[model samples]
Target: MRQYKKVLLGVASIVLIIVLAACGNIDDSSSSTSSSGKKTTSVQTTGQVSKSEYAGVIKNGHYLTSKARGLTANRNSNSLNITSFENGLLGVSKSYYSTSNYIFQEGQYLTTAKLTNWLGRKSKSNPTGLNPKDNGKKNSSRNPIYVESIEEQDFMQKNGNSLVLKGITIGIAMNTIDYYQKIKYGATYQQTITSKERVAYGKKVAKLIVERMRKIKKIGKNVPITIAMYKQAANDSLVGGSFYAKTQTTSSNISNWEKMNVENKVFPEISSTSDYASNDNKSFENFQSQIENYFPTISDVTAQAKYVNKKITGEQVTITTQFYSETEIISFTNFIAQVAPKFLPSGVPVNITVNSANGIQAFLSRSSTQRNFKSHVFSSY
Candidate 1:
């Protein structure tokens, strides 16, 4: 492992205690079935709390395109906490909040649900090619996958024994594309990855994840981050590895490798000036351009850990500090609320509120990319 420089990107808004005065009451009554078998509810009470108190963690969370690829996380943390499974079978929807009593899980989080709806619903010009006709009735059954594992990594720069710094890494492994293909195409499917398609989808997922998480922290700032996709070895030159260079050595090595391959990879495909001038240089440049044309760029965080010591030893223990800005927390929360509704108790109502200052501006900001993403609960009004 190599050391990377740590930078302070930006400070989150200070918590200013403001008075939010609101109150609600609830009453409940229970009844049992007299005739056959099923017991039903008589009366139920639901309450609302201040936004400041809206907090909880939903575990075993999953999204269904076919089966589930568990993408679980602490709703309050930026590090996407995930579990590892061999076939990418993990949870999709589990609800957790710090302030459980205050935050009502009965109704859906308005902004979160919309974002999720956008994720599953197909669009007329979806870059991923997933559409309504594509995800149809052949694959009818659906269930939220349960999570099995969880791991955290320390990614922090320490100064002294006083513990002046801290950071964390959370990862979730999933088989999302499996479900996507099964439901959309009526059979389990795997992504066909050409180098171009891989690069394009990789970039696409990276961009989306960044944009998705950026709501918490403006991306490319001080947040030292990395993401990678995990799949069986394809070409086998390298297994699913770090997306970008983590250490100086790795970065340099990757640069050298690219330089070595450039001549054979870039210029040999070009045509001569005579052919260019005579035949108009008909090339596959456009076909070869695998830009952000895929969905959910499969990725894992490439967290860099730093140290204050110049020496190394087996006894040496490194500590890192990681915290989520309120924005990032809300962004992740909204993401779960939007995408994980299918796993909630059956008949659970979901309402998404966005397009306002306090609503879900994070995802909706990408309006051009999310045209079909509409509000079914809140916007219904």
Candidate 2:
């Protein structure tokens, strides 16, 4: 019996050792996580803290409230309200308390002076062509006109019944001398000023913003920045309209900045009856299908279509058809002029061009003026 007791004691010692080892491992993991400045429980329970929780923490915080006030003053909107805040997170709403109005506002946490300096750099980079003193020459001013106002705001997008933070929009109002000239002289209509020029100027300003933001350590590495350039008119209001460009910092720090353009001037919602509001791609696809079924002999031809929305001349569709032989060109053009129009969106003008296998080209438009075969086609043959 004594021998059996000695064996049992040895087994109990081994079991105790295993239990202590497991407990030690758990403690070590917890300590490591805490040491790295992460709450193990919080991290394990939820990868992200809820916006509501953050709101509760900073609901009555004085510093954040002051910041919120400053944001409102800059945006020229009294609707901005800070509803929530956390260490590196902020939530704001405009007029409503719902998520749709709520914008998630967070960045590298820049000082007022730093933000001012960043805007100053952008001002210096403005293209000389847009400067009044240069008269559209390539003489960029050493002290280029800076943005009149700068504001950062989070805009929300509606998702079903709820609203989600879309992204941060940096609004900068620029009162360039050329912009004032355009407004006073209606140069925008005179073709002296163009949307392309404004878009190019907007891109330069956006590049500066992206460059400065990337240097900040606290800003989210993948967070996108949209720079909106608002042209201030003679009335002192930013009414000349705005152009914007969006950019994001990649892991390699190379920014693939998209071409800047005027904000979506195509108001589909307001003009539901307009053909420009219709899906051009879908219409083009249906037209191609009809052509294949109606004329099997020409079915092998490739057809491509594009829709363009011009502010002044309205909506236009361009269709290009490639024929297998010169003989098919005439038949194809006729089909495009008669049958293709039926599949197109109503009220939209279309220009159809037929390219023959022999390199001959003929174009026909809704108006008779544009209907012509190129003179080079006969000369080439």
Candidate 3:
């Protein structure tokens, strides 16, 4: 009986050892995840659904008050309101507030909330009147002129009187000359001018010119808009003859001229609208969509019908893309041509041919080269 007891004790020790080993292994490998001989994670995505598939509510509203004074933003509901401004201009002078809540799915925000708040008040017929600071005064500004080169002869012709030139505004043209004239001739005290008075006016004009030039710099870079002023004796000598550039130097001066011209002369004018429209409207959304629709989705020729307007035969869509280099254009075209087919529905056949002048043609009004290029490409389509 004693020998049997000893054997039973030894068996109990072995069982305890096995149980301890199993518990240790559980801590390292079996904590709520299957061990597939690969690294495991506690992150909570099943990976069956796409990250963008998660959805949330997005609501917004706009209210315009009958007073036509101000607009308010409702951030909680993701909405905006415009009130009492039907009679006034379209703008909200007051600051707006908003709030948002979002959820992360696969490290992406899949849900959101927002709130906006707004306040309104009665507005004046002339908003400028309500804002006592504005006082309905016109913005004071100086005109700018660009000259390739300034020489002594050009200076002599523009002496003291103002004149307008081609390809420039009257205000900017005159302002440039005014700068040099004051610097050269010292003014007398009184006669509606004195040392301090002249200095004040000079500083005021200079500041305006500098501000306008900053704008020009933003638009034209260092494109070099030169200002030149000349001084020549008056024909009668007693009239204090002065002829300035064709451009005026101040906004007030320009306004006066415009008002006068309407009643007096048919002035010659050159507008910069074309250049501004071309450069500034490059990324305009409306224009971008006009070209995006033409992209074909299938590789087969029959697939082209899916992208082509069925009602219109031989319809060709022209895309004007601004690219710094021709290589970028080629790469973009090839990328679209290659990838578009995979996304198309099964039956449609499509092809994309990039015309060489796609970038330049967009800027030109009616260049013969662009017309000919279009003719060559569409002749086959």
TM-score of each: 0.24, 0.32, 0.15
lDDT of 3: 0.21
Give the alpha-carbon lDDT of every model. Answer: 0.24, 0.36, 0.21
Question: Which is the leading candidate under lDDT?
Answer: 2
Q: Predicted candidate 2: what Cα RMSD to the true structure?
A: 25.4
In model 1, the Cα lDDT at residue 344 comes to 17
Model 1 TM-score, 2 decimals: 0.24
The list of candidate 3 runs beyond 4 A from truth reads: 1-256, 259-287, 293-381
The sequence of per-residue lDDT tens digits that candidate 2 reaches over residues 142-244 is: 2333344445654333354333444454555554332222233333211123446555665566566656665656444554445545543333321233333
**Deviating ranges (above 4 Å) for candidate 2:** 1-60, 63-103, 106-108, 121-143, 154-167, 176-198, 236-240, 244-381
Q: Where does model 1 exceed 4 Å of error?
A: 1-69, 72-191, 217-220, 232-381
- Return the top candidate by TM-score: 2
What 10-residue stretch in candidate 1 is worst by lDDT? 256-265
